[model samples]
Target: MALKDKQTEKNKHFIASLEFALQGIRTVFKEERNMRTHSLMGVLAIIAGFIFRLTTVEWLWLLFVIFFVLIIEIINTAFENVVDMCTDFHFHPIGKKIKDMAAGAVLITACFSLIVGSIIFLPKIWQLFVTYFL
Candidate 1:
């Protein structure tokens, strides 16, 4: 293909690739309860951030951590899926270990992100409630 033709082909398929990616997201969200919970938490965090009017840097950090947890959760799900596929739903110690590690990763990331969210938002939230009472 000519250079310009190749470029055109790539451009044409970009939207298709995005559609496929979105489809994956939809399927995961539909099938995974944890994903649904995380998405709800993410939305609530966004709402809280807006309510508090977090600074640009604070928003960046908050968003980074939020997205970090979510990305890890998605990876963990995919890892578990691959493990299950390999083990064919049978009882394998190694498969169990692999799945446990993936779950642990999600747990660790969620905890870390919770700390980050608290650090960034807790002070502001405390002030809001404290002032209302005072």
Candidate 2:
């Protein structure tokens, strides 16, 4: 669960920070189609985990995979937005390269997430198939 700040005057800055961070999440979900796809994937992963009756340790690792991928995806969105904001008319090679690298980062995270999901889910799914269909 996400940590919550105490509702006190002393915690105003912390509360505001949390709000800003949440706004980033909202922005990404609204503006990035890839973010929506990631959300769908996360939901499906959780549902599959429930179906497979994942161990606590496996669940924890899956949760880490979910959060890490989402975080990198958000960072990728932020990087692209910042690049667009900085460049106006014509494209700069450096900006293009930077944007490409940011996209590559997201792609790398996605590939890693897929590998982890396969490692965690594939054997369970295979067993289910063998037990019922094979």
Candidate 3:
């Protein structure tokens, strides 16, 4: 009986956790600018994958990179907002460092995604050119 009660409690907690997660998703879509940008990037990435005729594995890798950048951007934005909320004054070295570090993370992720995209697409483009005109 105790084991069954524990299992029931666990199920209830899981359902409540899922509800909270859904609310978070709704709030992210409703209020986050970075989320909007990420959504746009996701759409572009899907369109590009189709246009480039990527193999299934290559498309998976490309989407991974795209999602990785967006995830990093969202985390970075969250960090910045939290820092800003905690500090309202200018010229605070710690605050500046925190924001700078977060921004640097986003920049690094963006550069990495760019490199992955180039590596995946450049060869295919060259081959298409050769097949068409050479």
Candidate 4:
């Protein structure tokens, strides 16, 4: 009986935790410009995937890279917020380095995502252009 009660409590906690996570996502999307940009790119990717009729493997790769980029961006945003809080929004060399490093991480992930998108979309786009124009 005690074990069952514990399980029930855990289930309730999990649902509440999910709500908190969703709220965090909403907050980030609302407040973070980069997150909004990434989200727009992700939406475009999904639309292109449907238009191009991507294969299962290609879809998997597309989804993976999109989420990976978003995840990294979210982490970068979180890191920036924490650093700002810690530094009280003052300029410190270490704080600048921290923010720069976090930004670099987002840049690297964005570049990687762009490369993946090109690899997946360029061929299809070229084919479509040739089909229509030539």
Candidate 5:
């Protein structure tokens, strides 16, 4: 009976964690403009991948990049917000550097995603051009 109760409590904790995660997702979608933009870009990327008839592996790679960039952007935004909330315009150099570094991380992820997309799609695009024009 004690084991059963412990298992039930664990299940309840898992549910609560899920609820918290859902609330965070809602907050991001509702409060963060960049989150919305990233979501829109993700949708567009999925549509384009389908329209371009990407192979399963290609689609997987594209989706992986897209999700990675968006996740990093969200983390960067969260860090910036936390830093801003902690210091309200005190001109703290460390805080500024931390925020800048977070933004740089997002930028690096975005650039890498772009490179991955190009690597995955450029050959297919070139082949299509040759097939259509030559």
Candidate 6:
């Protein structure tokens, strides 16, 4: 193919790849309960950020931790699927260990996000309470 044709083909492939990724996200969201929960948490965090009127740096930190937890959860889900496939959905100690580790990763990231969220929001919440309730 010509150089211009190759560039056009690459662009087409990039768009198609993005579509495939989006489709995967949709499937995961539909099939995985944890994904739905994580998505809900992310939405709640966004709402809290708006309510608090977070500063730009605080917004960046909040968004980063939210997405970090979600990305880890997605990876954990993928690991679970792969482990299940590899073990033929049967009992296997190694497979159990792999799945456990993946879950632990998700848990750790979630805890990290919780800590970051507390750091960012607790003061705002306290101030609001003090201003209104005290």
Looking at candidate 4, the ten consecutive residues that score lowest on lDDT are 1-10
Best lDDT among the predictions, by candidate number: 4
**lDDT (tens digit, per residue) of candidate 3 on 55-105:** 988888898988897778767867777787888645678989998998898
Error of 3 at 51 (Å): 3.4
**In angstroms, how far off is 2's CA in candidate 6?**
19
- So what's the TM-score on candidate 2? 0.89
Candidate 6 global TM-score: 0.91
Deviation of model 5 at 21, angstroms: 0.9
Q: Number of backbone collisions per candidate, in order? A: 0, 0, 0, 0, 0, 0
After superposition, which runs of candidate 1 have C-alpha atoms over 4 Å from their true positions? Answer: 1-8
Per-candidate TM-scores read 0.88, 0.89, 0.74, 0.91, 0.82, 0.91
- Whole-model lDDT, model 3: 0.81
In the range 35-108, model 1's lDDT, one tens digit per residue, is: 88988898899999999999999899889988888888889889888988998889799999988999999999
**Each model's C-alpha lDDT?**
0.89, 0.89, 0.81, 0.92, 0.84, 0.91
Q: Write the per-residue lDDT of candidate 6 for residues 72-132, one digit (tens) a residue.
A: 9889989999999999999899999999999999999999999999999999999989999
lDDT of 5 by residue, 67-115 (tens): 9987887788788878888888576889999989998998898788879
* Candidate 3 error regions (>4 Å): 1-8, 88-91
Candidate 3 positional error at 42, Å: 2.6
Choose 4 or 5, whichever is better by lDDT: 4
Model 3: lowest-lDDT 10 consecutive positions: 1-10
Error of 3 at 44 (Å): 1.7
Q: What's model 6's overall lDDT?
A: 0.91
Kindly give the stretch of ten consecutive residues in candidate 2 with the minimal lDDT sum: 1-10
> Whole-model lDDT for model 1 versus the true structure?
0.89
